[model samples]
Target: MSFCLETYLQQSDDYEVLINKAGFKDCARLIRFKADEVIYVKPGEVILGVRIIGVPPIPIGIIENEKKLLIPYTKPCHGTSVVELPIDKKEIDNIRKLAI
Candidate 1:
């Protein structure tokens, strides 16, 4: 997939930033607390067009009712952010396949 998270965030307004400029642990905790279901993925997995980085078993939150995904997005200077974005069933399935 050629999806670029930076480009998407810049070009689109379809996503929501739940928590921004926070530490990785804080973001991870938010996902676990807010999400309907949680899935663990290995660090460096390509999710929503970005490679997630952090400790092992990175948390990806799935809100089935909203059809949305919550993920921690990290950048060098910006730290980590929890982004909630709508996703389709196919994409959700694909993400589930990568779960550890």
Candidate 2:
């Protein structure tokens, strides 16, 4: 409830970016180190109320009994990284709702 992906992306500076200007593959590789399972997402799809960015079929990692949704947020300069920030149940569910 406290961590909203949409709002965090806009209003906060309290998250960690492991890498920048990278790609989904890099993020996915990093996820393996932290998450228990991974959910691959199709390109041009929305999750956590935002459009997922990747080549195609991006990977989303979940952990701690689905309490967290690990998403790879990509930008033109900051390519992609597994956003290591706390998220709520509703946000996790939204990502599940759009899972491939």
Listed in order, each prediction's TM-score against the native is 0.93, 0.74
Quote the RMSD, in angstroms, for model 2: 3.1
Residues 1-100, model 1: lDDT tens digits = 5767778889999999999999999999999999998999999999877788888789999998899999998889999999998888888898999989
Q: Which pairs clash in the backbone of model 2?
A: 21-78, 21-79
lDDT of model 1 at position 95: 90
Q: Stretches of candidate 1 above 4 Å error?
A: none
For model 1, give the 10-residue run with minimal summed lDDT.
1-10
Give a tens-digit lDDT track for model 2, residues 1-100. Answer: 4434678767877666666666677787887677876777788686656777776667787785746657788777756767866666776666677667
Alpha-carbon lDDT, every model: 0.90, 0.71
